[model samples]
Target chain A: MEQELISKKELLELTKISYGQLYRWKRKNLIPEEWFIRKSTYTGQETFFPKERILDRIEKIKNMKGDVSLDELANMLSPNLTELVRKREDLIKLNIISKSTLEFYTEERGKDKELNFEKILYLSILDNLFDSGKINFDEGKLILTFLDEYYPKFKGKNCELLFLRKLGISSCCLVSKPNEINFENSMKVVEKLNISDLIEELKIKLV
Target chain B: MEKNMMNLEIKGSGSSEGGKYNTVVIKGNGKIDGNLDCNYLEVQGHCEVNGNVKSESVKVNGNNSIKGDLEADEIEIHGEVNVDGNLSVEKIHTHGMISVNGNCNAESFTMEGAFKIRGLLNAGELELKLHGPSEAREIGGEKIMVKRNGRVKFTRIRKLIMPFGFDTGLTTDIIEGDEIYLEYTNAKVVRGNDIELGSGCNIKLIEYQNEFKQHEEAEVVTYKKIRKT
Candidate 1:
């Protein structure tokens, strides 16, 4: 979990974003309902947010809102399109999942295997990371296994895939609760990305 | 055949509930429910809102309580305001007391009164000559200025009933911006491009890109000026 909690007052002062915008975003579903985070303070009940996440989200919203409408922004933040199934050709046409990864996926899971949206997202993420020179092909396979095993467990939460490489060995972990994207002492972070942001990026590219 | 209603007035204990209008004026103790989207809103007597208030301009003279968020181009508060949600405006000139449970965002915030905000206070130009103690958890902007009136005294009697119980000094955590000017403030970290700290500021860290100047009386524990990357 992101541990640092910032009071709503502090958030507003720091961002200078008004309460109306925050609540409007809440109403529009641009921010996760769980992030509202009500806590008891000396002065009755006050709202708090996971500082890092909210700050990143608000910055994203501010930057993207000028280009898109509020409803579209809400759609971008909305999650759980994981079960939507797409054909292999459609996924390639959508320019999300690469052909090489799709070939590899079909080879392992069988050509006729019906992959859901989450599996496709994982494959797309792996393909993109490898193509961008962030992760090796073998490390990508580890990330795929990690995602296939653990990504589905997180229903509505935003999770990230982290590939840690150390001493000529690499391992991947799914972080449902991320803190600082730690690389430890000597571990190299191969590639890390929040799944929802990947989905949004794909959506933007599709649009 | 038609009424050119450019303004609206509620007088003599009259009350109305929610609608859209061009301009709204409440002279008597009035109440409104639902969304109030108008061009201008002025409250001279006690007024209460049960929903959001959006207008081009808002001027509050008497006590007003908003159950929902408030948004406007310009909001001038000379009396008292109690808001249960966020407050977004272009320019806010507050001379009395205002309490917002949510964030306060504006292009420019000019305050000479007691203000309590539960959320961030972000703006372009934040100028304040605080009448009483005011507080926000985080304060950031392009050009930030906060100075406590020299004549004001931090008496024990005044500290007893203040809204947030903030002492006469302004207290905050991280204050980062491009140009920051502070006086009589206590902050954990102050980072900016051009920072000039006035007297009586207690800042733990001052990370600047270009210039950093502190008054002789201001106390800054750590400060660094780094080259722009």
Candidate 2:
């Protein structure tokens, strides 16, 4: 999908953030380097950003500025999943994972000793899919096992989790970000989740 | 792992393997064959590292080259240093010259001679006393000050030896900062809150929010004051 683009000049005007704050955020790694798209204009070289994403990010940063330090903010927004461990009891207490789902996850993957960030994320994804009453228990287990085996390979990289159904038979696929795939008419896309966004969401929820 | 937990000292023409060390001192021609992780790295002569250099503090008084990225808390350069990849440091103080083929990120950067960065130079507080031709693709900082130091005492001998005269200016495509004071800088666009175009600056377009000052010798094609909002 084509995203709306906004120039750096217009963004600063709309956001009311000075150049200093913008660069400072960039230096602090709160703003990812890939977002600063350099394009040549009639006048000269100009910087542009994905309109919706950047605006939302700036809004979130502004809201969380006074409460947390920029370094903490950077960690929260960073694409790389930081090393975090959450107990299964805490996950249940926080209502992040349904009890049934947690029970199923532990049954398939042995006992839950200490759920790391990646494990929790995978559980949450499975729970989200299962809670919607779309996928069955078998498919959920498939996802859990698939993620457990393959997710580490994509660490610190942007990836997508795709759920597709062909004539009521569901299968999942994982691909790196900025990818385009065409499905046949018989295939239906059940759900597509950007792993990076999920990571950000899980990070915020954990915080 | 415990076999090489020691300091490395190369006095004359020698080569050593790179690894974790408490301190690495090279006084003469030395070569490091692998990645180096050290607490303190002091080079007084010519040295080449084939891999990345990670140190808490790096002091270079002579020529040194690194084929990979450099990460250090503090980097002090008194002679010349060259990096084939990116440079990330907390503080950088240079009285001679340094060049990087990739982006440079620093918290505080102070320079007296010159620098050439193939990519963006991003710093929190950037101060440059230009003594020779310096260039970067783009520059972004909080407070940036660029001034020309006449005569170029440190580089005078090199200048006299060369038949052609060098331009004592900073050339960048774009410069963005909070408060910028520039001299002898040629940039296509300059955007900041309070900008001062010192003598011998050639800017194509300038966008400022609060205040904009231009010297008589500076040539600015166009300028506009941004809205307060």
Candidate 3:
């Protein structure tokens, strides 16, 4: 099903963001240029945006405005990740990935080739989760496998990684949007995070 | 100019239920605290109104600030206007500036000055000679043409005391229509059935269905021909 959309007028009213501020953000690249969708109406052409995406983005920009500059936000938002490679020890020195996770990954993959940038970034996310005790090493393996298998399907779209744990068994799925998961049978949704968010956080730490 | 007309002159702070008046003129620093309904309105000095304004003809020679919407048959601005709401007019000819906090819907919109619009600018026919840097978040109409003003002329001395100078150009997020021609515009995306881009334009993408032409000096990142859906 297609998601509902809201007009520019309605979005301004709902967000209480002034026109100058909206335009300023657009110029700042905090909001992507393509989100402005035009449709002919009874009066004339009107601009609309996907309600969910815009609402989420607006909330994020508002929350992170004073924390970082608009240019920094734009850099974090852009999906272009440069293929800058770092070794296992360097990643550990940068505090991105831990020794334990690298050992586990080396144990999984044959320890003969240089790891690409994507695997390093994924390892960084799993390291955060593993260090914080959000998900176990098995769940981390599942996440890495999911990235290796399913991430290409998302290709330039906002996506989230969902993990559900029940009775010591944890599973993960990738979704375009987050949702409430109530299995109603003693199951709990362990963690839900955007893959891009992980990349953004990692980029920040690396920078 | 019309000394013979019965004018509602606001010399100081004033309020009106906004009845049908011949002309409402604000000569000095004036403020209207209520709705204004008049045939003609002229602001020669700084003015602030707290309510909606409906007029047949409005001329601004100074600064005008309104907190509500504006509806007029014809509006001629040689000064600045700041509206907090929408502007629905048949014709608007501005030689100064107009900043609208809401949408602007006009039949024939012509400007030789600058403007900053927070919302859409929808018109039947929109033509502008950009005096400086102007901006509209979104613009939609049947035919829209904008050209940068590069004529060398002696500006008025009164403008030296005003707050704004000539507009540099225009920056828009999106501009879409049936026929669109823009010069000295920097836009993210422009979609029209018939489109022409003149010089000094830096656009990211342009999707046209019918006819498309661009000047040699203009730069466009992407151009596509799409079938009408």
- Of candidate 3 chain A, the 10-residue stretch with the lowest lDDT total is A18-27
Q: Per-residue lDDT of B1-229 in model 1, one digit per residue for the tens?
A: 1246456688867767778788899997988878888888999989999999999899999899999999998999889999899988878998888889987878788988777887777777788886777778766677788887645555445657665555566877767667788987888877677899887789887777778988999999889875453
Each model's interface RMSD (Å)?
A: 9.9, 1.0, 13.0
Residues A99-168 of candidate 2 have per-residue lDDT tens digits of: 9998998788889678989888898888888888878999998888888789999987878899989988
- Which residue runs of candidate 2 sit more than 4 Å off their true CA positions? A179-187, B1-4, B150-166
Query: What DockQ was computed for model 3?
Result: 0.01
lDDT of 3 by residue, B97-118 (tens): 8999998888789998889999
Output the better candidate (1/2) by TM-score.
2
For model 2, residues B166-200, the per-residue Cα lDDT tens digits are: 57899999999999999999999999999999988
Instruction: State the local distance difference test value for candidate 2.
Output: 0.91
lDDT of 3 by residue, A1-207 (tens): 367899976786688664445654664556765677888875356679989978888888898889998878887776556465666677778877788988988877757345566777677767767887998777788888887898777755666777788888788877863344446678887776777767766766766
Best by lDDT: 2
For candidate 1, what is the DockQ-based docking class?
Answer: incorrect
Instruction: Return whichever of 1 and 2 wins on lDDT.
Output: 2
lDDT tens digits, residues A1-207, model 1? 337999876786677665446655664668786787877665334678999989988888998988999877887677656336767777788778788888877766678646666677778787878788877666767777777777768756677767778998888777774345555688987777777777767656544
Please state the CAPRI-style docking class of candidate 2: medium
- DockQ leader: 2
The local distance difference test score of each candidate is: 0.77, 0.91, 0.78
